[model samples]
Target: MKRILLINPWIEDVSAYDYWLKPLGLLYISSALKTLGVEPVLVDCLDRYDSDLLSYSSGSGEKYFGTGKFVETVVPKPDCIASIPRRFKRFGFPEEVFRSKLQQLDHVDGVFVTSMMTYWHYGVSDTIRVVRQELPSIPIVLGGVYATLLPEHAKRNAGADLVCPGTGMKPIEKALLFLGINKSVQPDWFDELSPDYSAYESPHYAVVITSLGCPFRCVYCASSYLWRHFLRRDPTKTAEHIEYLVKSSNLSDIVFFDDAILVGGGFKTLMKEIEHRSIRTRFHLPNGVHARFVDRETADLMYANNFKTIKIGLETSDRALQTSTGGKVFLNDIYRAVDNLSKAGFTYKEISAYIMLNLPGQSEEDVLDSLRICEELGLSPTLNEFTPIPGTLQWKELIERGSFAEDIDPLLLDNSIIPHWWKQGFSLDTVQRLKEAAWSLRRKLSGE
Candidate 1:
């Protein structure tokens, strides 16, 4: 049997949190290679339970349903963002620890590296470098969002033997074939194979990708650029996975990582199956759901099925901006969704509206108005800062206006630096005041 190694690269960013985050794509690939009779060794740099890492942990302690911060080491800022006033850090295992882990592997035929945010490519590049230093002759393949969105940049910067773009398990199979190990079996959909979460230490919560690719292409989003087409997994199969998880362990929560979970009627069917199975796991839709899809039936089903957290994408209240920015949602859609959710016995505090800020031409008042609309509708507000992604419409506009450099380092793309670093149309004071107002409203609603 061919031996294959898979790695989850560390994240080099100002800050990062583990909100039930897991590399589902990489796990799925692991499942595929194992089924093809390849011996797979999985190494996650961000593994929280690593005995060596835990010894060095600062005793931050996990909080709130197994979701908390990742222990990070402060590193020097990259030259491109040297002027920015925030400390850069690597949010995973230390260099020596990672190298020691690599040294333990033997005669690996191929290595697969996974990436996350575009700005966090520094981690991916560093991981590839260390892998090359440790295993010089093995072929390395890089894949994930950063590779898919900015393939040319990754090719030029990320020192990998090959870079595979987009979704699916074909890249892993292809890499195995390169090593002269071929599986002459009938092809099946990538989503059909269950992700191998058993590879990790027991996890308290799991992430489920019931669907992929959103139909609406928001100007600031890279969903369309990354996924080939919209796809949804079989509802019964998804329920079976959830049931297996609950039965195998004390799994109490699940976070839906779908870009759009309710695009089709699949959510309703999945809920029905879960209800039939009597599985009592709490569900969270951290990725914003489409407001237009929330009807009386779906809303009630979600409430009945124990969806504790629901966040809706209400980008802006400006009608023209709404129409221009992909027309995904509007003021009326927000009102209707909120009404339906309230009727389903969900409290206002349970449902939050994501109001986007810091667009190229977006003003402070525009964002403030959206917050006001959400407040009027008795919904809590979450301020989502706009980060210019490589292939998006807003990215091109920022580049044309000379506000962003043609060869800008991806580190500057962090969303938290919006008001602090970039002054597109709003001043620092305006941004500060608007943020304060939003938080103030949230506190008042929660009676904190």
Candidate 2:
């Protein structure tokens, strides 16, 4: 059988955490490759449960709910951000471990690398560079959010023989064709294929998306740009996949990675299916759900289904800011949603509110007011620093407004680093203060 080696590259950033992060797209591609009769081998650098990695880290244990820090090694900051004072680090398995894994593989047909944030392209390029050194003759393909968002940049810098942009099986098919394999994937692959979690030896958590894309066009979000239309899987099929994961793997957590999981009421149906199947597992919704859709029934369903972590997208409590940013939610929506969740037996610890900071034209008071509202509603506050995505409406608007040059380095767009460079928004000290405020509020809510 023809073999393709799949790699999830290291994350070179100031900081990163494995908040139930999984290469779901790559796993799906692995399944697709299998269906096409191609053998797919995986080398996931971020797999915290990787036995080799565990041994390398001296058997460090994971934190609560299988979410914990990646093994980090401090690295020099890129020249563009050298002025920034924070220490830049590569967060994942050591380079030696990755190289050792590559050396063990025998005669792979090609290599496929997946990327995450657009700013993390440095990691992608470095990963491909190493792959080239190891297997000089083998072709390498790059695909994922970074490549899709900035294809030309990836082609120029990522060092891949072929860069497949966009989503779904089409990108995987493109990669296969580049390898001279002419095979078409099934049309219903989205629903038919499950992420090949068998790639991991023993994952603590498995992330599953019941839907693709978002229905709302939030200014700062790229979900609408990434996927033009919204689509959902059969809830029964989704439940079946969950049951399979529970039965086949030693998984303690199931995370939903959908951008808008609660839009069409399919989540409720899926909850009922899980209940019907009697599959007991700790579920989490780290992705911010639309508060407008969080009715009493939905809250009850989430509670009955044992959702351990629920995050509601309450971007800002300011009325104008709420309407300007796609109007997907409002202050009243947040109020009602919290009430429903609290009535459904979810306490402040189980529920959290996503309060965005550093939004264009937003004031410090706006963020403080949002935090105050979270406190009043008895919900933990999570401060999400706003990073203007490349193709989103917000990015374009900022460029047009002359916030920064159109061709600014994507790495400077990192939220932690943006405050240092993006002068139109918050200063580095102000951002620090805002983070401290959020932390204080969280402590207060937790009764610390």
Candidate 3:
């Protein structure tokens, strides 16, 4: 059988955390490759539970609910952001460990590497460099969010033999074809396949996507752009998959990574199925859900199904800004949703609201007002620092209006680094103040 090596690269950034971070796309691709009669060898750099990693670190870094910090090593800053006064670090397995893993692997036909954030392209490039050094003759392929959003940049910089830049099985098929494998991937692979978690041993949590793509076209979001249409799996089948994970893997926590999980009524049905099966495990919705969909029934279902983390997307409380940016939620919708969640027995600690900072045309007062609303509703506030996505409407508007050069380094667009260079948005001092305010509110809500 043909063997293919799959790699989840290290995240090179100023800071990184493992909030149940699973390479869902890579795992799905692994499953697809398996269905095509290929063997997949996984080298998940972020797998904290790997025995080799545990031996290297001398212990695990796990904190509460399978969410914690990644093992980090300080590295030299890239010339583009070298002047930024923060330490640039690579967060994942040590370099020697990665090299050791690669050396131990048996003969493989090709190597596939997956990437995440666009700003993390440096990580992708570095990963591909190491792969090339270790296996000089093997073909390397790169695909993921970064590759899809910045195909040209990835092609120029990522150093992949072939850069497949699309979603679903199309990219996988392309990679397979590039390797002379004549397998046609099914279009309905999203519904037919589950992320291959078998590669992980003793994982604290698992992430499942009930649906792909978002129906709402928020200017700042890339979900609608990445996925052309919203596709949902059979709720019953999804629940069965969850049950299998719970029973087979002994997983206690399951996270929903859907961009718009609650857009349709499917989430409610899925929750009902989980309840019917009496699958006793914690559920988390770290991705913000639409406030308009959090009706009493939905909130009740979430609470009944043991949802431990519930975050509502209340990007901004400004009425005009709300309408201007997708109009997905308004003040009253937030109020009603919070009321329903509260009535359903969710406490302030279990619920939170996402408030965006540094958005174009947004003032400091707008963000402060949104935080005040979260305070009034007794929900913790999660201040999301804005990062300009390349293909979004906001990105095009920024480029057209000369906010920054179109060929600007993607690293400068990172939320942590944007304030230092981008003058159009809030300055570094102002962003610091806003973060402090949000942190204070979270501390208050947590009774700290």
Candidate 4:
């Protein structure tokens, strides 16, 4: 029997919070391996329920709506940013715990490691180093956003035998063959395999994606580079999987990780199925939704189907900026969507508007205008600092215009750095003022 091990690497950053973080791509690979009759074991570093790690934390790991914090440990700063004057930490199990977990798995034929956010490659590098020391001969394969975007950099620095990119499973299949395991698992994307989260121990929430990729090519987003094309699963089958998870696992919270959920009536059809089956669960879209798609009918369906959390992308009120950055939503579109959702009984607190800040040429006035607009519409404003992603339009333009260094390390792409690291003309003080304005609006709206 071929037994493979999968590891979700720790997140190394100045600050981190668990906003329903799960290695969905790695879980899909596990599910596909299972379908091919291969045994798979998982070591999720960010498992909040792990009693050993929870024992070290100051607070119990209870979560609200399946969103919470990860138990973290302070770690040394990378030499590149040592003078940044912030406490760098690893947001997950301690190193000893990870090593102990790896030691427990016997006869591991091969290993698969996954990464997120390209800038967190330090965590990926550290995880691979530990794996090599423990299982010297076992071949390790790396995959995920970081691997896909910066394949050569990850291959050179991540210390993995092979780096697999994109959604296809061909590279992994080939890696297994190289390891003397002769079996072929059809790619899960074609079959639309439901990720088997049963491997998790008492998970509070499960993430499901009815669709993959977005049609709109946002300048700052890398969805097109990672996915290449938009593909959606059968809505009926998606509803069935959701029903199974809710009933069997006694779970109430399900998050949609789709880059864009409403490609072609996908959201409406899935909601209708859930309503017909009477599957009552709180749906969440931490990934922003397209404001233009939310009409009167869609809003009512979302409310009827119990969408507890809804975030619409209104990146900027500047019409030119909006047009250049995919133009998926207009000012009128947001206004109408909020109106429809409000009429359908969703309160202002339930609807959140995502306003992007700290883009290449974004000004303080632009950001402040967006916040004021959201406040006027009675929607909670959430500020998202822009990160320059590789292979995106913004990245290419930044490099061409001499705004960003061409040879910049991916680690510097942290969103937290904001205007200080990647702005065109904004000062740190201006960025601070913008954050303060956003916070004040949020507090006033919440009546805090």
Candidate 5:
């Protein structure tokens, strides 16, 4: 059997943290590789559960908070990202530990890497650099959101031997086939297997996905970038995975990375099944939940199922921004949804509404107004700046009107580090003042 290694790289960013955040793409790919009869070893650079972190991650050792803090080292910020105020970190284990871990694996055929948030491509590059230094000839293939969105850049600059864009099902099979590994058998699509989290060399949280893809094309989002369509397993399958974690692993909190979990999709039928069966599990949807689908009954179902924290995408309170950006939700929808969640027995502070700011033509007044509106609805406001995703409808306009390079580096795709600061009718100071005003209102609204 040919040995294959899958690596989930670290994060290079200003003020990074983890919240049940697992690389679902990597886990799914790893599971698929095993199904193909490829003996795979999964290496995670962002190991909060590193055994060496006896004092930090655990005492004599266990990971903290289900998914705990990363072992990060403050590094020099890249030239492209230096303008940002905060010190950035390379979030993961020490380089020596990574190297030592790699050396232990014998006769690895090829290595596969996964990436997320386009801005974090540097972490991917850094991981590749380490891997190449240790094992010169092993082919390093990169895939996931960033690779899918900017394949050319990933191939050219990110140092991957080949980039697998979009879904890795066909590409991974093709990758294995090229190496002369053929499997005449197929495994169950719902691989209820607990990801070989044991490969981490430390006790830590696991990454699992209940479904795939989001149904809507929110102009600024890349949910549709990786997967062109949406699909979900029978809730029974997902529930089984949850049960496995709770019963076997003794995990209490798991995060759902689904973009639109219950968005009028077949999720209702399946979610209902899990609830009716009264599965004793507590789940978290740390990825922003879709507000438009939150009818009173759905809210009640989610609440009864022990979903503790819920975040909604109320990108802007302005009807125009809501309709124009995603056509996914609007003002009346926010009002009704908030009412539903509130009636379903959630305190205002228990919920968060993600507010989108800094879109190319978005107004500062609109940004603050959106925050104010969230306060009125009695939900905490979380501001998420708009970063233009390539291949989306807005990508065309950013090139036409903004300061973005026609050849902007893919690393500039990080949202926390603003890439495209827009001018409201050519007012340069508008960006600064708008951000300040939004922050002020947030403080006042939350009574901080």
Candidate 6:
């Protein structure tokens, strides 16, 4: 039997929070391997419920829905931006604990690591360093958003024996072939694989993905770059996965991480099946779904079926910014859509409007007006800081701007600090005030 060590690496940044994030990509690979009959062991660095971490922190020791702060430690800067005035941290288990955990794994033939935000390659690099030091010669494969975005840079810096940009199921399959293990059947994208997450202590959330990729090629987003094509599953099959998780795993809250859930350019039959028969499940879309996809009929279908958390990307009120951010939707479209959702019988509090901020040359006033629009539309405004992704259009603009060097340490692109917050007169205080007000209003609307 092949023993594989799957890792969700530590996050290195200024500030890190648990916003219902899990390594769905890594878990998919883990589950896929298990279904293929490999012995997969997980060593998630960001396990908030790790016995070593829980032994130290206060507050009930742990929380549910994979929502809680990670045990973090201050670390030195990467010397490129040592002048940046903020404490950098490694958000996860301590190194000693990590090493001890790795040792406990005994013997593993191979390692699979997952990466998130491209700039967090520092975290990816550090994680690779530890893995290489411990195992020395286990063929390690790196794949995920970071690996996908910066393939060449990661190929050199990540020090992995093999690097998988985007989906590397083929590469993984090839490696397994070399090792004399063969799959009787090929791995299909939509075929549901049973994931056993019992290895991690108190793993609570079940990630239920109904589809893959997005149709909209938003210039700022990497969804297109990652998958390049959109695909959906048989709704009956999707419901079956959700049913199994809820019934067997006891995870009621299942987050759907699809780029667009209901755009059903295909699989309309599957969607109708889900609309009719998906059993009790609390759905979440922390990644935010496209509002344009949700019509009165579809919204009603979602609400009636299984969706609990409804979030949509309204980007901003400024029409120019809307076009600038890829012209995904117009202001009036959101207002009418919000009306339809309420008419379909969902409360205003259940609706969330994602207001994006910190674009190149965007004013604070622009961000504020977007927030005002959300407030007026009776939607909760969730402010997300913009980070310049490497291959996106914004990356070229940042390169044209001052002092941004090529391959200059990925840590500068952390969204929390806002690398290029240089729009004339915008103060951090003003940004903070806008965010605080947005949160307060959202809470009031939520009545929570």
Q: Clash totals for all models, in order?
A: 0, 0, 0, 0, 0, 0
TM-score of each: 0.94, 0.98, 0.98, 0.96, 0.88, 0.89
Worst 10 residues of 3 by lDDT: 416-425
Off by over 4 Å in 5: 55-68, 81-86, 183-207, 413-415, 418-420, 424-448
lDDT of each: 0.82, 0.90, 0.91, 0.84, 0.72, 0.74
**Candidate 1 vs candidate 2: which has greater TM-score?**
2
TM match of model 4 to true structure: 0.96
- Pairs of residues clashing in candidate 1: none
Model 3 error, position 339 (Å): 0.5
Q: Candidate 5 — which pairs collide?
A: none
lDDT of 1 by residue, 1-448 (tens): 7888999999988788887778888888777777778878888887765666677676434776667777788988888778878888887788888898889878888998988888999989988999999999999999888888888889999999888877676665565666677763225654478778787666677887888788788888888877768888898999999899878867878888899998977999999998999988888898889999999899999988898889999878888888898999877778899999999999865799888877766777888898888778888898977788898887887788787786777877786644555545567777778889999989888889
**Which pairs of residues clash in candidate 3, taking residues 3 or more apart in a chain or in different chains?**
none
> Between which residue pairs do clashes occur in model 6?
none
lDDT of 1 at 214: 81
For residue 224, model 6's alpha carbon misses the true position, in angstroms, by 0.4
| Model 1 misplaced stretches (Cα beyond 4 Å) | 58-60, 183-187, 418-423
Off-target runs (Cα >4 Å) in candidate 3 are: none
Model 4 lDDT tens row, 72-150: 7899888877777778899888888888888877978888899898889999999999999999999998888898888
Candidate 2: regions farther than 4 A off? none
Model 4 lDDT, residue 387, Cα: 80
The residue-by-residue lDDT of candidate 6 on 4-105, one tens digit each, is 888999998887876666787777667777778898888888877677766765532245445667778898887866888888899888899889888777
* Residue 350 in model 2: lDDT: 90
